[model samples]
Target: MTDTDWGELAQHWLDRLADCSVPGAGVTRLPFTPEHRRALGVLTELMEEAGLVVRLDAAGTLIGRLGGPESAPALLMGSHQDSVREGGAYDGIMGVVLPVLALMKLRHDEVTLPFAVEVLAFADEEGVRFPSALMGPRALAGTFDMATLDLHDSDGITLRRAMEEFGLNPDSLPDLKRNPTQVLGWVEIHLEQGPVLESAGLNIGIVTGICGIERHMVTLTGKAAHAGTVPMHLRNDALAGAAELTLATETLAHETDGLLATVGALHVRPGVVNAVPGEVSLTLEIRALNDALRECAGAAITHTARDIATRRGLSLDIARTYAQGATTCSSKSIEHLCKAVATGSRSEVRRLVSGATHDTSAMAELCSVGMVFTACRDGISHHPSELVSEKAMTAGIQTLEQYLIQLQ
Candidate 1:
């Protein structure tokens, strides 16, 4: 296929994948759902059309393999197929499609390599369905915690039960761990999910690393009282304290370099407008490529929240819900990806740290990992407005194919 055709195919497949979502504004193909099953069917057909042997692993990772020689350590490339709640079409799915198209182009050309190639469609990365995300990569890396199987989702379904319902034996998860020595490194093609590339007028970039993430689940306690009867000064309002903390976090992020602080979720109790909100629950998320910076920002947010609660006569309860340390990409992999992009674009490839976590972070534990990023519109992602142009995708496929050829 020509470059233009590759781009067209990437976009077409993305549109089809988007349709395998809940009837909503954006894609919502969570792991183990009917939509996920439908998407698997579509992907399986495409993988087979590219002349690959396919299988869904015990961890629910859909893999497509192109054989090389006997006992050869295969070069793995892929991304997750799952989407966040109402997330954009390209966020996770594009990573899976771009590599498939690259392999298709290679197969069309009848190019043979010394090393086997495998494209992986990881089942979960967004942690939307279950709090314990990155199941597929971690399981493959042999880092999966069996205890997480008991974790429940919104509908009270355990992770183990979900896997069982999906026709996967939960007992087989441990056996799915791969031998790192027999495996080549992992390369993930993903959207930049930021404005750096677009601002720099570049179509592609290389990832330096995945940022560390920490989430704070906070609750402020105050007395619930009648909104009309209680005077503003006398009422201990938890929502007011939460509002103050939110602004404080925003200011901290703005002031600190390399720090990203967001109060993405907030819930007010006794939700009725007429009732003075006596209790509030909120989530404070902190991220940074530097672990020290992330920790410092998180500490600052905690201090700020505590102060807000104390000054407002409200009690504060804070718990750490999630913590993932930063992960640097393989230096060799970055050089290889950059060389390919530089060859394709006839210019330098931009390099940036991914503020958002990815399956690559989990995959890194299994093997050396690298990532190539395509530009997204206005640096938006995980939203309905997120977009990547066909031209950009075409460039992405070409880059991946060249990288594969060069790797061989």
Candidate 2:
């Protein structure tokens, strides 16, 4: 198939899934939801039509396989299917579609590789429904904590219940663990999700590493008082303390190079217009390509929160919810990706550190992994405005197809 043919196919698949999302809003295919299942069904059909054998794992991860020599370790590719609430369509979907189309193009050309290739559409990389990210890949890596089965969503649905409702048995998740020796490596073709590639005037980027992430839940408590009666000097306000800590987080991240800290969620109570907030709860997320930097930032933020609470006479508590170390792509896989980009484009293939985490970060625990990033419009991602040009998509597919051929 020609580039035009592949581009049209990609657009067709994207548009098909687009209907599963809320109209005029961004994509919201949360894990195990009806929309997510519908999207997976569409993708499964497309994969089968591409001449791949398709199956669904116990964790609801979709896998499409192409054969190689018997006893040869297979190469894994693709990304997650679930999106953050009202998120863009291309963030995770592009990774899955590109590989399927690349394989289809290979089949059309009658080319066969010596190593098997498996396309993975992970179930819950966004963690929008669950409290943690990378759930799907973590399950396959045998790192999924069974305790998370009790974790509840906004609708009061436990992860285990959600799995069962979606036709997956949580007890069977252990069976999905992949044998390390049976998998050669993983390669994900994702959108850059940032403007680095576009700024560098390149159509694609080879990811050097994924950022480490630390997530925390912070709560500040104080005595509730009447808003009008409480004197500024006498008041102990949890909301005020939280605000100070939030600004401190932003300041520290700005002062520290390559560190990013965000207070994405906040809640205040008694949540009344006439009452001074007695408690404030917020989520803190720290990320950096360097592990040391990430740790330092987390420590600094924690210290700042404590200091703010002490000054305000409010009690402070911090609970770490998640922590993931930085991950570097394997050297051999990087070499293969670079060669693929060189063969497909005249522009220099740039190596970049991803500020955002991906399913490949979890897969790195199972086997060697690498990633290719197509430039997205501006630096936008996880939003409705996220997009990639048709030309860039075509380039990504060509590069991926060439990379797969090199694996033979």
- Give TM-scores for every candidate, taking all chains together and pairing residue i with residue i: 0.91, 0.89
Question: Which pairs, if any, clash in model 2?
Answer: none
Q: Candidate 2 lDDT, tens digit per residue, 1-408?
A: 567677777888987887777556888788888888899889999999998999998888899999888888899999988887778889898899999999988888889889999999998888888886787788889988889999999889999999999999889877788999999899998999888899988998899999999999999999899999888889889998998998989998888888989999999999999999999999999999899989888888888888888889999899888898999999988999999999976579999899888999999889899999999899799998788877788888888989988887
Best by TM-score: 1
* Candidate 2: RMSD to truth: 2.7
Instruction: Give per-residue CA lDDT, model 1, range 315-408, as digits (tens).
Output: 9999888999999999999998899998876666899999888999998999999998999899999998899999889889888888888987
Native-vs-model 1 lDDT? 0.90
Model 1 ranges off by over 4 Å: 222-237, 269-277
Which segments of candidate 2 are over 4 A away from where they belong? Answer: 22-24, 221-240, 269-279, 311-313
